[model samples]
Target: MDVTIQELKQREAEGKNDYVLLDVREDYERAEFNVGGIHIPLGVLTASFDKLANHKDDEIIVYCRSGKRSGMAQHLLQQSGFTNVRNLEGGMLAYQG
Candidate 1:
């Protein structure tokens, strides 16, 4: 599953923090800029699944450098029993625009 940048922005405008936005990028990538997401690098997501366990089955939006990693993460989360996982389409590059 995926969400457009506009949809995400509208959700933000609605003050909807109900969804968890997970950033699978590296720490350095996050330091440069992010969509106010939790800093969980892709390399650590699986091992640190406990940290995100609470968000499972919730509205979780995963993203990465170019959407590839996040897509993988989304798949992993789904396999791990996360019900409402979505990938941010086009990633931050699209969001920045």
Candidate 2:
């Protein structure tokens, strides 16, 4: 499911730290700006699965520059048994809006 930046902000305000916010963009992209997420570039998601093992069943909010990479990552997570995964509606661009 797609979540708006406003909704994500709300969740953060609520101290919803139970979820894992996965930023699937590249390192340079993250260096520019990010919504305080765990950076794990899309190309390395499968290899970095161990980094997110703790959040297998936990809520995961994935995002990228335009939601493309993150959306794909979300599906991959689901396929790997991630029960709760959400893709930022429009990624950083949407959030910036």
Candidate 3:
């Protein structure tokens, strides 16, 4: 599944954080501008699984600069048994738009 920037922003405006936001961009990319979330770059996401194991059953919204990296991360997490993983549609690009 996927989430649009509008929907995400709406949720934030409502102060609804029932999901886990996972930023899959690199350190420098995040250092530029970010919506804030668990910072686990895609390259090390697999090794960082333990950091997210606790939220395995929770809604996890993965995102990156463009949606590509996060889409890959979403797949990896799902393959690892994450029941609900949603890639942010168009990712940060759309969010920033």
Candidate 4:
């Protein structure tokens, strides 16, 4: 599942922190602009799987510079037994659009 930037904003405005916002972009990209998500670059996602083990059943919203990397992240998490995972439709690009 993919969510729009507006939808994400609405969730945030409503003070909903029930889900995990996973940012899979590179550090530099995140430093440039981000939505305040957990910083885990795509390259090390698998190795850092343990950090997310406790949230396997929680809704996770993955994002990146253009949604590509985060899409891969979403797939990886799903394969790793993550139940509710969603990709930001167009990542930060869409968010900043």
Candidate 5:
């Protein structure tokens, strides 16, 4: 599944933090600018799945520079038994901010 930047912003505006927002971008990219998602590089997502064990059933929104990497991250999460995962469509590049 996927979500647009506008939808994400609306979710934030509603003070909804119950879901997990995962940033699959690299450190440098995140340092440049980010939407305050948890910093977890895509390459190490599988290895770091344990960090998100508790969020398996929670809604997870993943984003990267573009949508590609985050889409991959979403797939891995689903394969690993994550019930609700969504890739940020167009990623940060499409963010209005």
Candidate 6:
């Protein structure tokens, strides 16, 4: 599933903290800008997935420059048995826009 920027912003505005933000962008990209979260680049995600075992059932929101990479990450997390992985629709582009 996917979450829109407006939904995320509304949650932030309401102070309803109930999800995890997983930024899948590269280090440089994150350095440029980030909404903040667990910093794990998608390139090393396969090797680092074990780091997220404790969050298998938690709501994890994945994002990148565009929605494509995060969509892939969402599929990967779902395949790996993560129960609530969601991709940020339109990714940072929509968020910044």
Pick the lDDT winner. Answer: 3
Tens-digit per-residue lDDT, 1-97, candidate 6: 7899999999999998899999999999999989999988888897899889889999999999998999988998898999999999999988999
lDDT of 5: 0.90
Deviation from native of the Cα of residue 72 in model 5, angstroms: 0.4
The count of backbone overlaps in candidate 6 is: 0
lDDT of 4 at 33: 96
Separately for all candidates shown, the number of backbone clashes (residues 3 or more apart, or on different chains) is: 0, 0, 0, 0, 0, 0
> At residue 12, what lDDT does model 4 achieve?
91
lDDT of each: 0.89, 0.90, 0.95, 0.92, 0.90, 0.91
Clashes in predicted model 4? 0
- Those runs of model 3 whose alpha carbons end farther than 4 Å from true positions after fitting are none
lDDT of 5 at 59: 96
* Residue runs of model 5 more than 4 Å from their true location after superposition: none
User: Could you give candidate 3's per-residue lDDT for residues 21-61 as a string of tens digits?
Assistant: 99999999999989998999999999999999999999999
| Clash count, candidate 5 | 0
Q: Where does the lowest 10-residue lDDT sum fall in candidate 6?
A: 38-47
lDDT of 2 by residue, 1-97 (tens): 7778888989889987777899999989998889886899999999999999988888899999998899999999999999999999888888877
Please list the residue runs of candidate 6 whose C-alpha ends up more than 4 Å from where it truly belongs after superposition.
none
lDDT of 1: 0.89
- Please estimate how well model 4 matches the true structure, expressed as its whole-model Cα lDDT: 0.92
lDDT of 4 by residue, 30-63 (tens): 8999888689999999999999988899999999
Clashing pairs in 5: none
Q: Model 4 segments beyond 4 Å from truth?
A: none
